[model samples]
Target: MAHREPVVVTDEPTIGKLVVDASRDVSGLIQKEIALAKSELRVSVKAGGLSIGLFAGAAFLGLLAIIMLSVAIAHFISFTGLDLAWGFLIVFFLYVLLAGLLAFVGLKKVKKVRPPEKAIGQAKAIPGAFKGKS
Candidate 1:
């Protein structure tokens, strides 16, 4: 005959201890989530900075190209028997018109910019979610 050892059963955890444990777990989970968000934002910020630098470099090059093209256009106008001063003046007025058009378009686009609705909705729902009311 085989001998069997006596089994002991432990008592269930108290409500206070359970609540404390759950709170601790939730706090730790929130901390980890915050850390993850910070990590993602750090990466995104670095990429955004790099993209801005690249755009700036491209813009500088474009400015140089525009200046050279303007000089060439002025020379072409002068070659066609217009006075050199008149050529430059015409080019200046042309650039002014172009600038006005660009400003108008940019303003329109900027006016269309709105806040992130989905993120805002989720943020507003967070309190209700924690209260167990979806």
Candidate 2:
């Protein structure tokens, strides 16, 4: 590749030349920033969409697992010689018990999840620090 000599601007350049150079530089900078932002947004959006899709798939599989578990339990109960109707009723009772246990566990978890107090205090202190500095 042939290398060309760089052009040099004189100290006594015309007003029009300065204006043109500044405008070109500013427009190039803006175009570069826009391209960078667009690239970042594309990557972030793709990852977010894929994450959502995976979560949806997980939820669907979890529902299937629950259905399979209920069927298995019902079949196990019926193995004891009880009628299918009675077995299903027992499964329903077991489901109710499981639901109550899950609700209690969820409640406990919610109670344990306190706000980020230290983080909040530090964030609040930021404005004060900035004010004092100014």
Candidate 3:
């Protein structure tokens, strides 16, 4: 790798020159960081979107399979001396019960999801550190 020129600190170096150099370096660093983030974000977003779409398609097909399987189960129930309508209702009622249970569980889980306290605390510490108060 090529070497950078060493900075010469001498009595003649004014504060203004030092500040200007620091500003330039910081600006360049920010620009490069932004470019890197954009490239990474573009690739990550494309891959994540493709995976999400494929998974959604798979879930849709899986749902269809489950529906067909449920209908078969209901038909089997009908063969057990119950009326066809009653057999289907039995399956329907069981599904309703499952739906209610899942809804309750999901709501409980959602209620548990709160803001990320650790991340928020760390973020709040930044300004204090920058201001030399930490």
Residue 79 displacement in candidate 3 (angstroms): 2.3
**Better structure of 1 and 2 per lDDT:** 1
Write the residue-wise lDDT of candidate 3 on 9-83 in tens digits. 768868899999999999999999999999999999999999999999999999999899888988999999988
Candidate with the greatest lDDT versus the true structure: 1
Give Cα distance to truth, residue 105, candidate 2, Å.
2.7
* lDDT by residue for model 2 (1-134), tens: 99999998778989999999999999999999999999999999999999999999999999999899888888888999998788889999988999999999999999999899999989989998989952
**Ranked by lDDT, top first:** 1, 3, 2
CA lDDT for candidate 1: 0.97
**Best-fitting candidate, measured by TM-score?**
2
How high is the CA lDDT of each candidate model? 0.97, 0.93, 0.95
Worst 10 residues of 1 by lDDT: 5-14
In candidate 3 the C-alpha lDDT for residue 131 amounts to: 94
Assess every candidate by TM-score.
Answer: 0.60, 0.63, 0.56
